[model samples]
Target chain A: MEARTKAEVLRRLRSVAGHVEGIARMVEEDAYCIDIIRQIQAVQRALAKVNDLVLAQHLRACVTTAIRGEDPEERERVLEEIVEVFEAAQKI
Target chain B: MEARTKAEVLRRLRSVAGHVEGIARMVEEDAYCIDIIRQIQAVQRALAKVNDLVLAQHLRACVTTAIRGEDPEERERVLEEIVEVFEAAQKI
Candidate 1:
């Protein structure tokens, strides 16, 4: 990952971590069930955004390089890797 | 997504959902902090795996098609998208 991206991811992760900690406290205190679930949902969404960013980076750096490279075999390998990932995603 | 992968993903997601419910119960009962944290960690890891699988699918179905297609402009567009994703990731 680029330096800037790395910093941003870390920042977001830290924020998420803090949020999680607060949720834990809420749980301990017997906070409202709906409120806790709502917080969890927000965290999940934030994490999804992070995941999207990483995947995009992988495509640009790894997938793009394979496609642009001269070697046919490398291109094929990249293609297969992508297919594997798709298969995995489908499982999810 | 393939049928088999789709089934698997759904199964895992259901399992995770159940696990989350369990965690919520634990919170309600004032479970041990460490234990709750451990379960949360496991859930997070499971979630990460799901994200990876989705990303892989995107790369295979979307990125691969763009790379192999005849239109240079389409390829460029895909590349730009990948770059944008990377940029977005950095902001995470």
Candidate 2:
């Protein structure tokens, strides 16, 4: 719920987008192996922060609701989604 | 932000917590291999939904902020975090 925090996240994402594009360029230009790897690593770090922010929000909001709500279907769907993400995350 | 959506997320999380605890129990009891694996897989799925929800929020809020704000530190921190998460996810 930090409006400012949300804005900050977005700004960082845009910068990351540029770096990603740079990675594509490096590949096209046949950049050095380490350089490419370094860029990839940079992308990874950027994603981690985004991950933290999301997790924080979920704990604050989603987790709060699921406890009080009586609808099982909604709860199930959310549970299913979490599993999906965790699985996908494992792959990445 | 959908207030209702937040609530739903919480409910799902509680159920997942139960499942995770169950997995711990299975480990202690030396439950069937398949059963333990299945429970771990289930946990993975639950994490995924939370991931998506947070990502949506980031795109909506953080990305928007970085675009408008002049602060570079906030942006950098966010980017760094993303990369960290991405790497951790890879390990998982």
The lDDT of each candidate is 0.73, 0.67
Weakest 10 consecutive residues, lDDT, candidate 1 chain B?
B83-92
Q: What is candidate 2's lDDT per residue for A1-92, written digit by digit as tens?
A: 56876897888889899999999999999999999999899898787667666655654356335523576676555545544554466666
Please give, for residues B22-42, the per-residue lDDT of candidate 1 as tens digits. 999999999999999999989
Q: Please give, as one word, the docking class of candidate 1.
A: incorrect
In model 1, the clashing pairs are A5-B90, A86-B57, A89-B53, A90-B5, A91-B5, A91-B9, A92-B9
**What's the lDDT for residue B81 in model 1?**
67
In model 1, which regions exceed 4 Å deviation? A70-77, A80-92, B1-73, B79-92
> Tell me, what's the RMSD of every candidate?
10.6, 12.7
RMSD of candidate 2 to the truth, in angstroms, is 12.7
Best by TM-score: 1
Candidate 2 deviant stretches above 4 angstroms: B1-90
